[model samples]
Target: MSGRTPSTRLADTIGARPVSASAVVYPGKVWDVVSEDVDLGRAGTVTREIIRHPGAVGVLALDDEGRVALVHQYRHPVGMTLWELPAGLLDVEGEPPLLAAQRELAEEADLRAGRWDVLLDWVLSPGGSTEAFRCYLARDLSPVPEADRHQRDGEELDMPTEWFDLDEVHTAVLANRLNSPSLVVGVLAAHASRALGWSTVKPADSPWPEHPKLR
Candidate 1:
């Protein structure tokens, strides 16, 4: 074996193939369906359909008492009401990821954070979508002022908010009870970071080169 340990060797490989043709097949409300003909070096060229998304950010708000803030919202695609981290799309032009996470925390959880760290970054669905997601570990929590709270609408209206022990959430994740991607990944990443004394956490504004730029 080489000198690289598991920690040093564990990383996703990145490469790009030439796309001969690309077009938007379906323009949806939130995202678009894209079709592309990519040139494979050795293998023959292939056409792929992709979901072009605007990306998103999530916040795992941890209080000093070892509890996490979560929101119960209905996801129509999955047809389930899930306990998930406060999260939102990066739809607003020119808004930073950290700012989006902050806004989501305040809007969905009615909370704010004084300190933020990047907990995890992932591709929501690499096989079918260009949706890059980031999760933040937010601490030094405080309630959003009532006057400044965002007006909830649609699925957000009447959404319930609750606090749960981090351990409880972790157990739920392990038991397959929590199905929200953000909540599952954020909770597990937060747990691992905490176990490592937060040494694995990155700055809230850490460089995100993997996130695709939207036109």
Candidate 2:
């Protein structure tokens, strides 16, 4: 047998904490707060309060010219409009994450892509929220006529969107100019993917078991 201990091998495996008991402590419009007692083998049981989320999707739309499409919209939480990639929530009933990404790209940027690849996936805050994110790299883009665009409201109304060189976006990500977790991860991941000739990119329909909504 290998020198790795059983406990170490188990940690390397994909595992789920068996839920001994769970209940919603608070229900809200966007998410619900839930308390759960989980059983962790070899480590006694523990209770945790989780923000049950439906998850979300983001797009890094790249044109053939190597420009990335971005949007400037005000986020009330931060009290500032941020520069971010086209993105949206996965709240639509029965909608898959990839489809949500496509819809968001069109809605937020008035654009679409002929090809798409899964750039990366991540959990926003495992300790607090069950929010998972999938950042897609959209290539060979085209414009959606003004008439075909999704109507906007509030912060998104009259939003300003533009295309920036991927290299510049990558630099912003490194310099913390574009620091939203989704944008940062998406831009850097896209740069790395392109460097590998997209070998690192997974098919648009690739499995995303990390999103709690799926579970």
Task: Compare the candidates by TM-score and give the number of the best one.
Answer: 1
- lDDT, candidate 1, 75-193, per-residue tens: 88889989999899999999998989988889899998999999999998999999999999999999988999999887788688999999999999999999999999999999988
List CA RMSD, all candidates.
Answer: 2.2, 4.0
Alpha carbon deviation, residue 119, candidate 2 (Å)? 1.0
- TM-score, every prediction: 0.94, 0.90
In candidate 2, position 199 carries an lDDT of 88
lDDT of 2 by residue, 1-215 (tens): 79965775553234578999999999999999999999987898999999998899999988878998889877778787788988988999999888899999988888988998888988899879989899998988888988888888876786789889999989988887775778888888888878989889899998887875564
The list of candidate 2 runs beyond 4 A from truth reads 1-13
Show where candidate 1 strays beyond 4 Å. 1-9
Weakest ten-residue segment in model 1 by summed lDDT: 8-17
Count clashing residue pairs per candidate. Answer: 0, 0
For model 1, state the Cα shift of residue 161 in Å: 0.9
